[model samples]
Target chain A: MARAKKPKLAVWKFASCDGCQLSLLDCEDELLAVAANVDIAHFPEATRAVIAGPYDLSLVEGSITTPDDAERIHKIRRRSKRLITIGACATAGGIQALRNFARIDDYINYVYARPEYIDTLAKSTPIHDHVWVDFELRGCPIDRFQLVEVINAFLNERRPNIPRYSQCVECKRSGAVCVMVSRGTLCLGPVTQAGCGNLCPPLGRGCYGCFGPMEAPNTMSLAGWFREKDTSADAVRDLFRTFNAGAAPFRKESEAHEQR
Target chain B: MKPAGSTDPLPAIIDKGGLQVLIDALIGGGFTVIAPRLTDGVIALDTITSVDHLPAGATDEQEAGYYRVHDGGGGRLFDYATTPQGWKRYLYPPEERLWQAKREGAGFAIVEERAPVPRYAFLGVRACDLRAIGILDAVFDHGRSAEPRYVARRDQALIIGVNCTRAGSTCFCTSMGTGPAVGTGADLVLTEFGDDAAPALLVEARSPAGRKVFARLGGRQAAAEDIEAADAAVAKAATMVTRHMATDAAAILKRNLEHREWAKVAQRCLGCANCTLVCPTCFCGSVEDTTDLTGATAARWRRWDSCFTSDFSYIHGGSIRRSGASRYRQWMTHKLSHWWQQFGSSGCVGCGRCITWCPVGIDITEQVRRIKDSEGGPH
Candidate 1:
């Protein structure tokens, strides 16, 4: 009888809160069950145990901020059969990418007491910028349930059933009254992806792009609405330039509004 | 029975005393009933026992930047315009224990706790709140693969919606095309007509499950007079609202992204995250793990987090939004502008919780208008 080979799984981190990687550990009950099916090859955050890769699945978290990290991702790409970027940092440049719009040296000096000891890059970039990623899980800290679905989909050799639509669909499905229409409140549900469920709005708040931009987000139209509502252009521009600041749509929008 | 129309039928009158019997009936039917009670001078949702716990004859006075209690209302128990709390708390808790873990021998052992699906009856849910729940259903249930936790709670839950008899000063659900009246998305919708008049509840069945529950309620079939009263109540509430936003506001917001009015609003804003927390649809969150003293056992938790926090946008060694201005801008734009691009609808539900709870009282409508009126170019 022939024995089935166990799939190798690896987890990597870059520039982020470690919340996204914790989503895996957050899968406490599911973790062991997942490990049972695959070989726990490399995960520095969860366990010290390390295994050489040629990994069947690689879950990379955070973004590349330094030259070393940029090069390291390329090496990871070569060794993994399928590379998946998890969280806002790995897919977009993350909130840290906000520095991409400003001077890096100034920011470094502002935070670090010993700026000389810090070796950094001009910009923080997503994994896709450095290497190919088979799948990208959106969210600041990716939804664990959704994360599990992605893993299961990959394991089953099928496309993940992640929604590419905006948060508005979720708002509609939730049957929430449009805050902008009823309260004249600004909200991001229409442009944000539907991963966090309809959390902010139900709480009487608007959606923030922690999950990053949705597919082909129509930011211009939404911004126009904000303008009529009295939201300033600088305010709209600044909104797109946060967390997922380096994302294409948000980045382009912010650049269009750049003062200098 | 008369055909169901856009109005409530049967002038469904429920005495203030009957509330306990209704609640008891729901509980006896193996349903967990959640209702609003006075908490910190504000109406908040909590599990209830009887009619005594309901805020009877109480009404709230809501303003553009304030919310307060007002005296002298009918004998009706649920007379408030809207509450700060929504239905998401029971369905999607702020902090949930995803699972627990421990080290076993040389290897580690993990245990997954599948959330117990409870049969819930959400009582006193407002029209806007019902709409919010429907939006959540799309995200949690409509997809090809359902979210196990969300699906479990939603599938077994029953909704009892309440129509707005009075509008809040900040309410603009009419502009959003969501509320003032309960249009759809409810197992039953109740509207309080007036003090002189009996409390009328218009019950409509949206699903087979709802129909079953409706049949069990044993209420008399609604008549035209009952529905007429209900219609009058909704119309009165719609007219009571003082705030309004343009329908084409989303498109205008998109075009004005480069407008210069943001700096002024940013000046007064503090990125404290109160707005996100009070929001009905804001879903951004973070995860944490707590280990025993021995570090041998650990339990991971997922908690509510806000983007307004410095740590929320942290990257590499620092944060992306180093200034309050940028963070505030990010939050508003995502909520109103980019939301349409990503989700095909606006993110906000117009509950007005953020404005009332903002501590500093930042009115979103005013902020948007200022930006729109500003002459300076994009930042």
Candidate 2:
């Protein structure tokens, strides 16, 4: 029997850390197995060998923070069949999305001595905001096991099993006592999505909302409890102003707290 | 005070040696004993073959949204507080494959994924956790579709409940009418007490299996003084718990449907779902069917799901409960009120996992108080 042609997998980056793409490279044990299954098309972080698109699976990292990034994503989307966005930046507009709340121009003027040279957009956005996204893997840096799962699911034409539930579930599974319950520490595990495998809770620290809000998150009730701890409204606002601040639910909640 | 559970057959004195004998009996008879072990700086429930594997000298300090473990310097075994991992993890895992389908020739063949549930003899289960398992049992058993895996795992598992001699700062199982003492839903319940020099356990067997296991250990029959000591320990635990749910929970949650407290909470909530996930009895979940990109093979699996997510209530025409207020209201109301009508008991065992795991320290008792205060409900 003739061997079937392998699907070309391309990884692209935009205006953030290369962590998500590095997550793919970090799959050391599985990298060889993954390479055998698919063609490494245009992962600049891994190799300079670039294969032209019309690729099968395109994994996108980082947020669309620049005007060039906004236009480039559409072209990438057009050339790919299944385009999956990875990490907080590509799925929910990353930490840089804080600009969505404040003025980006002010940041450009303050950071860059030559303010006229800046080519960034007013607001950082996810790939889905500009172009169609087949799937979005939510995380700050993204989970490696999930990255493998997502690729495997897509290659098999199956829906990804990445849960939309909160990190509290993961915390329980991993056997980390509730930092909130045990130490009176503030954690974001309750309403945040599960992907990181209860990382922050085991360390006796709270989840910083790295995976974004879970399904139908009830932030109002949780925030009221936060206020009970003598936390001011500004502190509450800053809490929501995190890795996934531009995500709609988080953004809306932050905006609501801003009024106070 | 309120009808404390009656532990029959009286208790037997099981010193350190007797406990080891009991562990040896379980191990020899094909039971995988699981106990709390200090791993990665946390006291986690992990596999143990010997009594020596149990966490010793370590004590946990727990508060709202916070937990810390410090060495208390020797002797007692079950001296720690609650673990982040619960029995639900073993019985109803975070991820379990349901079935898989593959393309072969003209038609696709499907295969059901099955694995034999292990016989686990759980050591150091707190009263709240034991009650939680009971609540979970009712949920899985009473549902139209019983979780066969949960049923199998639960039925085969042996429970060893540990009475709380010292409560964590966040503990309130006493207030919820759940704990502070080893009561029900276990094969054996042990109350740790006596002088530090002669550390002892007052062991009570709830079932025939428990008695058989206990009898094999060759422990001396407990005297009246041992029972008295156990009672004193329970009484001390009940009074020691400082955290209390001051409000009438059911009444407050039921009446405050559209309270302003919901809005205030939503602002800081972040809807993280930690509370529900940490909760021992929260059994809500969703399934997913997946395959590689080729459309060649497909597999279905179930994972734990929480109502605190935006996608939890999502339908074809967007989300049913879009606002954070509605999601928060749904979770608390369901846990406190809806669970009673659905099952025969409240979903919460008041393990305080939700409060401790909550990154922002969103105390469940505090939220209930707010609702109670806003409506001027009974204290």
Candidate 3:
């Protein structure tokens, strides 16, 4: 006749725009059910309430930018039973990871009024690059339903059903005409992962690789074709250097097309 | 009413106006009429009420990884070869809920999805697509463990075949022995001709249901010359298709599964799975189970899957088809060779959607020819 204690769920932010965290709050209808199921222990964005660890599940957002934040994540990892990296930031070092390509001190001197006050790392890296990540839910801003699915899977002790296939599969499944083939628009749907619900292509815009490179993505083949056709080598390079620019395959691809 | 397998009715000549009468009859008979119309800059199948909804005076140019719509120069309905999206989506949807479970007390109550299936009259069904449907029938309807949803939807469907007067550059239906002129499966078949002069259609009923719809048209019998003109139009379409698939591809592909050409193709292949997704008869699907946050309800969904995905061949350790070469080999070999062993026929209907829709433009016919050309070479 006793109710069991609920699993503690924590949402952590490091170097993100807080958009990924907003996805959870945006689950307005499912929030009630989610609240009932899990203990919202330490979500500073949603509630000032802070419950002590070790937390049952921690949903980490944003990349590890500062050295202090890097050390803080390892502590968070130690305190959490299951650590999931949500959004392109935590999984592949967000758009800010574009800074990873250049000198950090030069960027600091160029942008900051007080360069001496700013404390950061040489490279903006993903959480998994610093510590172990149980699972990664990819997107510029992660799909809320997929985030829910990942949490639900953790609760149910099952593998999450997030797809690792190209966005073209979703386009075909939804019967969306291929923007690239039909209109000669340059699209990254062939190499980008399929968690965005086939977003940009249907609107006559090409996929921007928001969900990062798909599993074993043939980036070279796609880039080669794009460069051979209307797209310039620089354009093709910049195509892979967006939201998930720090992802390994994309990083290698963009570097391949470097003007040097 | 005539029996279901009644003999074929004679072909009748119907003007452009008579085509509208047939559309009305189908709509009146409580069927959702899906026809080819221009949408999103390409010919697509969608619901229509009148014949004007069809893509008249319009045609498309399709090549490997390219498609463009242009003025066909003549006021003829059914001028296009085939849309990238096929009739498969109607019979076998991209995704469907299989069942749902809701917790009551200690146990949950399982509810099987029994949603009412719609009776569809698919207008502008190309010959190759018709054959693709036949292949799907074997996969879903004819099997012992028949898919209930597919069987119900297919049973309540009416096929309105359209003979191709012009072929896309990617099309090779003649090599596949499937198109240019329709054979067998349709309830009614239409051939468009005399676009510059009269703009007439030759309608033939191949089934009893089609005969009933044909009788409703009350059109004049097709003259010998009208039939000749219609035949000539389809014959020209056959000549337009320059691509060819080796007739002994089934044997040749099976023999050369480990050919060096597989690796060569992998270099150009993005492994995007667009080829399989757009393919008419690929027919691979996977199921996903999900539960709500409350844990009170759970549902299972079936969605189209492709071998190009790493997880498609996942077992305990890792995927069987780990390399792009292996996955591409599995798809092509299954379509051209293993399909015959499993279903007594090739899986590909030569619709050429794979060629047109592929981002990298990897042509299946060309790949087959390359493998066949260097058959029994170094593995």
Find the candidate with the highest DockQ and give its number: 3
lDDT of 3 by residue, B198-298 (tens): 58889998888999999999789888888889999999999999888989889898889788998999999999999998898989999999887667789
Q: For every candidate, how close is chain A to the native chain A in TM-score?
A: 0.94, 0.96, 0.98
The per-model lDDT (C-alpha) reads 0.72, 0.81, 0.91
DockQ of each: 0.02, 0.42, 0.67
Which has the better DockQ: candidate 2, or candidate 3?
A: 3
TM-score of 2: 0.80
Estimated TM-score for each candidate: 0.57, 0.80, 0.97
Tens digits of per-residue lDDT for model 2, B1-379: 1134744465788888888888888988789888888876678888987777777777888777677889887677877778866778888887788989988988899987778789999988999999899888898875678888889888889998999888888888988888888667788888888876457988888888887887776778888788888889878888878888753687668877888899888776767677777789888777777765456677887877778766678789977877877888899999887778888667778888788767767788889987777765355
Over A1-260, each residue of candidate 3 has an lDDT whose tens digit, in order, gives: 11277899999999999999999998888777678789999999999999999999999999999989989999999999999999999999999999988999999999999999999999889999999999999998999889888888887777889999999999999889999999989899999999987779889999999999999789999999898896888899899999999999999999999998
Candidate 2 - CAPRI tier? acceptable
i-RMSD values for every candidate model: 14.2, 4.5, 2.4
Evaluated at residue B337, the lDDT of candidate 1 is 74
